[model samples]
Target: MNALVPLPVLLPLCATGLSLAFGTRLKQFQRFISVAVLTAVLGLSVALMIAADMNGPLSVHLGDFAPPLGITLVADRLSGLMLTVSSAVTLCVLVYSLGQGMADRDEETPVAVFHPAYLILVAGVSCTFLAGDLVNLYVGFEIMLVASFVLLTLGGTGPRIRAGSTYVIISLFSSMLFLTAIAMTYAATGTANFAQLAGRLAELPLGVQTLIQGMLLTVFAIKAAVFPLAAWLPDSYPTAPAPVTAVFAGLLTKVGVYCMLRTETLLFPGNRLGDLLMAAALASMVVGILGAVAQTDLKRLLSFTLISHIGYMVFGIGLATREAYGGAIVYVVHHITVQTTLFLVAGLIERRGGTTELTRLGGIAKAAPVLAVLFFVPAMNLAGIPPLSGFIGKLGLMRAGVADGSVWAWILVIGSTATSLLTLYVMAKVWNLAFWRAAPPGQAADGTVLESDDDSDDDTDEGPDRMPGTGDEGVRPRHEPAGRAVAATLHGHAVTTTTRLPRLMTWATAATVALGLAYTVFAGPLTAYTDRSAAELIARVPYVEAVLGR
Candidate 1:
């Protein structure tokens, strides 16, 4: 039983190693390995969740070493829930990537690098969730950063390189901050084990505690892309290939949020930065949604909304109640599936329409109703439409805020509601422009918008200015190149030359949508589990005892 605890992290690392060892020769086998490994990890996660629920926070001391010294991997309710959700999400994304890889078989960015790097990324996420010490957690974060840098720059497009550079520099800066905090922590307490830190951090002076807390939260904030720190995300994420962007948007930022939850509840239970967190949450929601509202490109719009929704999680953290934390947990799981599905759908949109620009995309509803539905389901879920997981999660958070009954919480309540409304409006706008409208002027029957069309000047003259940074020096416009497609329009569809979206990609995306819906179906049990998880997090003693064996 104890042996199973490390498998989630170990399996991915082994998969990555095998992928690397095989290199390009076994590329086909690597895909099968990726799926099998992630599926196995998902089963293990489900087992972990059940076992943790039954026995309370099962743990393993690596190499038979004990607490505050040896490596540890624990799957309490919180970590188990995260592992399960993340495993499910990563598996969906892995299938999506396989579809992408198979479809564009000869596309730049070696397939050999993709499987190993992606598996390593999964390992990092699993390690981050399972780590029982701050140092191990830091290692996980670094592993993720390194893998992400490769994934981000995969195609080596000029824009991808520039965007990847920004992402790497930001990741490194945040990492330095995290490492500095770890140093301060170890120097202050002489131990890095989470259980030990929980007991010892309080022994430091109030000022010292606050200082350390501020530094650590700032580091996480950068990783999480909370408010001011979020400016880098919208530009950076959209440049990657569809599958990479989807996984990064869904999983990476949440890892930071995960760490924040651990630090706020376990190590620094007082939550000295409550007001700061609340303020940042409000700022992120309002600012991010507003940015989304202005974006005319599908990917950029989603990227902005990603930043906005992080505010919701941070808001729940600010409230610091069990209900609020549970709500955040629920929201995190829902968002992971829903957001990833949307980006995968975006890939389909780009493939079929030859672009994701609102001005350039059209006739998706007519050309591929499946694409429209795939995009619509998750868009509605993301906007918090009723009877969906998004609604359930948001309702939980709103109720928690009301139950807290603080003036600031109420203010955030209002902010949350407004953000939801704006989110809906944004999705509706996307529906209108991308699915409902006729093809853009000069759109060829093959879905290619003629770049040099006589009406091209008319487009700029007629519509709002293109986004400022969107057209900056290095960035490629969201529209893919208009390859040599014969030009003609018929019956309101401009995409006569549309490439068929890969069936594998579509099915993978559809399955993810189903996964998001499943959260609504299983909300009762999931929420109950989260409630228990939040209680364990807040109580902290069981975790300590589980680790200390006292």
Candidate 2:
């Protein structure tokens, strides 16, 4: 079992290589293999979490060589928790893609590459969380970026290609900055391993330590999409395939936030940059929500909301107390599950209704009732509705802010609450346009009707194949019942219409909703694990001892 510690990272890397070797000839096998590998990794992550919770940190050194010489995979409570969540989310996304026929041979070449590239992305995320050293973490980031670049440009559509170019450039620039930071840290501290860096960092003068901290934070902030550096996120995330967008939404930004938490609490104790972080956090919250409110596209709105919520995590980091850090840890776990679910649900809407543009979509509640419920639950949770995981996370941060009694913290509390309200507004905008409004005249049963030649033959079109609105001009529209009634009416109205969920898509949505509920039910234990993880991170003593024994 101990030997299996590196399987999560290795399995994906191996799969990537095999997929490349086989090319598109064995796409089905690639999908099956990827799913099996991820499933096994998910199981391992759960086992690791249980074992680490019962024991202490778990470590497996490569080639039986000790740390400082060979690579090591360490699974403390935090790393284990993140690995579990990330793996599960990736698995759900894979299921969703299979449902969308994205993994099928009929898909375009770039889209066909998703299975292999997504596996590589998962490996990178797993490595990032499990890595025991700074250089390893940087390697993980680079691998993830390369995989993401391919996934983002799947289909090679004009919009996707344009957005992807910007994404690639920004990601490459940030990676270079990260490499520079790692190099500088190694020079200053004479060690690249995190545990050793902690000890070495403590020995340095406060000024020098602050400089290193600044460099590291700048690099991670670009990854995390923090304010001023966050412009790229809103533009890039909305253009990808829904399944890819879901995984990116749930895992990518959190990876950056995870790095920040580690650096602030573990590498730089008694850090004085809290105030600067506070300012940045506030800006992110305000600016992100504002952008969300102005968006008409469902994906873009959710993208903006993502940036807004990141501020709360950073707010916790700024407080720099055990309670604050603990809250941040739990919040990170909560946000990952919720954010990914929301994005996946968005994908479902796009698939069922044929368009993600709110202005063009309506009455999805009538067509996909189950999807409506799925999207609604997470939407409310993200708006911080009481009793849900999102509300609990925000409440924890607010309570910590109150207890700390810092003026900036108090402002963050108020700002986060306001952002929540605005987030609700943005979500409501999507809900109203997608679920509440009536389908326009001569439009397909699902709000969108083909008016142009370009839209007529679109694969997403589901209505009668007759010429546009011409057939509808002679016939008067009949009043249809609302909600479930509409589904029954649609059935009676168009017996020949195809409107069933694909088996894989159904499973994917179920899995995502189940994960959200699981987080809510298991919140107590999860939070407890995160608390222990936060405590260990803040102290850094246990980690240092483990890596460089006494």
TM-score of each: 0.91, 0.90
Largest TM-score belongs to which candidate?
1
Q: Which lDDT value does model 1 have at 6?
A: 93
Cα lDDT of model 2 by residue, 325-377, tens digit:
88888888888888888887776665565446677667667766887888888
lDDT at 174 for candidate 2? 87
Model 1 earns a TM-score of 0.91
Against the true structure, whose lDDT is highest? 1
Q: After superposition, how far is residue 396 of candidate 1 from its true place, in Å?
A: 0.7
Candidate 2 has which clashing residue pairs, if any? none
Worst-scoring 10-residue span by lDDT in model 2: 485-494
Q: Please report, in order, the local distance difference test score of every candidate based on alpha carbons.
A: 0.83, 0.77
